[model samples]
Target: MFERFTKDARSAVVDAQQVARAAHSDQIDSRHLLVALAESEGLARTALADGGLDVTDVVARARASIEAGDALDHGALAAVGIDLDEVTRRTEATFGEGALARAGRVLRVRRKHIPFTPDAKKSLELALREAIRLGSKEINGGHLLLGLTRAESPGRRVLADAGADLERVRRHAEGASEAV
Candidate 1:
């Protein structure tokens, strides 16, 4: 997995691990990862803040969800912190019944571990590239947030209504492509 990360991504993962520990969670979920990304000061950080989903707010929502035991399924994942429905839809569409199995697997994975899914990997790559274009040293939570926002999944309309800046995310991706 280290090989899969750019230096900055590895750093983000490290930060996520710390957040997981601080939260007293045995594993690092996407919410923690998003926080790590935001702390890393990447493109998604500014964009997400611009869209009104700041780290403090997201963390509060995640904590509330956890306390409410709302982190049950993918639906719960959204209710807690990662509000990008589009990405959830993509995960469902890409993995289908396998999505449930994979999500379970994700649950079983440790905070120090990175779950593997082709869609997740693709999204991560695209996000990291976007981070690089914004002069970020690593992939951050903002990048993951944008990836989810722009995902062509069932949650698209829901996320748009939530005010996710999909267009800005796309613009960043476009800039990343040009940089590449």
Candidate 2:
């Protein structure tokens, strides 16, 4: 399957790992893949741009998801009588400001070769299926984007949250794949 990927498609996969690492995530998921696709030129970028979604915003969303645990869940913990804010305040007071964030940064320094989450693997598989469905000899970035839209992953959720028209993106990606 990898051998069938176009250069842009392979680059997107490599860049997705970079995106995951930048987000301080231990594993790459579709959100990271989507960010990679959005940043890269070609059918995926065009499909996202046509939907009025900016690349910066998409990357930000993926980062937020991956780094969600960087900060304690104040509200949820507060409901359980664990005031994370108070804990942070006291910890910071004793350890100096931004101590927790510094620790988080240290812990986030992952080694090379971050692995993909199941959803990411599934999305890539779906991308191959998409290429086959479209009768394309090789998988391109557009097929990857279409795969993301079809999968139930954080990327798909972010796309919807960012007000991307899923059907519109699909149509545009399919059309664009033909031209590739």
TM-score of each: 0.46, 0.87
RMSD of 2: 2.2
Task: Give Cα distance to truth, residue 28, candidate 2, Å.
Answer: 1.4
Model 2: per-residue lDDT, tens digit, 1-180? 999999999999999988877766778888889889988787899888876777678767766766674445556787899977778789899899988766766786846667898999999999999999999999999999999999678889988887778898889889889887
lDDT of 2: 0.85
Which parts of model 1 have CA positions greater than 4 angstroms off?
1-4, 70-145, 148-163, 169-180
Candidate 2, TM-score vs. the true structure? 0.87
Return the number of clashes found in candidate 2: 0
Candidate 1: lDDT over CA atoms? 0.53
